[model samples]
Target: MKIKDRVIELLSDKYCGLLPIKSIHEEDTIIDIGFDSLRFMEFVVLIEEEYHIEFPDDLLDIQSTTTVREVIERLEKEV
Candidate 1:
């Protein structure tokens, strides 16, 4: 699966009332997926678990991430 799609699945599997898949991808903002602080941290944890890597606290700046691709790229670099 595309990393973006996988990210969505990882999130949707954990929560309800997700935006339509099409709508989620129509924009570049991953946070537009209706994620708050708690869910944002959860996404970080999921990325670490899914990729078998760790996201160091100092490396993660949630404010700068706007899309799943951005998130995956950062995590991929870390992994």
Candidate 2:
């Protein structure tokens, strides 16, 4: 699947439908979807494992400001 689709799928799985998938916008921040630090870490791990690519540590630092579109773009470059 495409990176955006996979990202959305992962987000949906993690959030358990708390936010409708159709309502997710590219500009939404991770925290906007209720992703606390721990949950964000877990999601990052899933993404790394799924794509076999490790994101830089800096990503964790800036995760609060990171958007869905940014994540998908980064994953596209890595994968």
Candidate 3:
């Protein structure tokens, strides 16, 4: 699957079950989806496992505020 589609699937399964995938926009940040610090970390780890890549230290700190578009861009690079 495309990175964006996988992301939406992950988010839907792991966090926002009630929110439809169609409602999630690339411009939406993790926090915009109601992810707190704990959920954010869980998601980061999930993505890392899915892609077999550890996120860089710099990216970890700002991830909660990073938009889905930016996340997809970074994930594409990592993968």
Candidate 4:
């Protein structure tokens, strides 16, 4: 499965509402999602489990500048 698909699956399971996947896939940040702290934590859990790698602390500091592609890039780097 693709990265987007895995993300969508986790979102569905976690009921994370609608992620701005299209915008993120286009190299745009997911700023429109308005994901709060709780949701962002869930996203981090999903990323960790899906990629099987602990995310660096810096990812938590990236605010509206982080995109799905960028996240995937980070995961690939660790994997």
The candidate that wins on TM-score is: 2
Looking at model 4, residue 52 earns an lDDT score of: 83
Residue pairs clashing in model 4 are: none
TM-score of each: 0.62, 0.81, 0.78, 0.64
Evaluate all candidate structures by whole-model CA lDDT and list the values in order.
0.62, 0.74, 0.73, 0.61
Off by over 4 Å in 3: 13-18, 63-65
Model 1 lDDT per residue over 38-78, tens place: 66777777777887877667545556456656665655566
- RMSD of model 4 against the true structure: 3.1
Candidate 2 residue lDDT tens string, 1-79:
7789878878764443246677677899877876777777777888778888887666765456888788778778878
Sort by lDDT, best first.
2, 3, 1, 4
Worst 10 residues of 1 by lDDT: 13-22
Higher-lDDT candidate among 3 and 4? 3
Candidate 1 positional error at 62, Å: 2.2
Comparing 3 and 4 on TM-score, the stronger one? 3
On the 0 to 100 scale, the lDDT of residue 44 in model 4 is: 80
User: How much does candidate 1 score in TM-score?
Assistant: 0.62
Best by lDDT: 2
Candidate 3: Cα lDDT at 53: 85
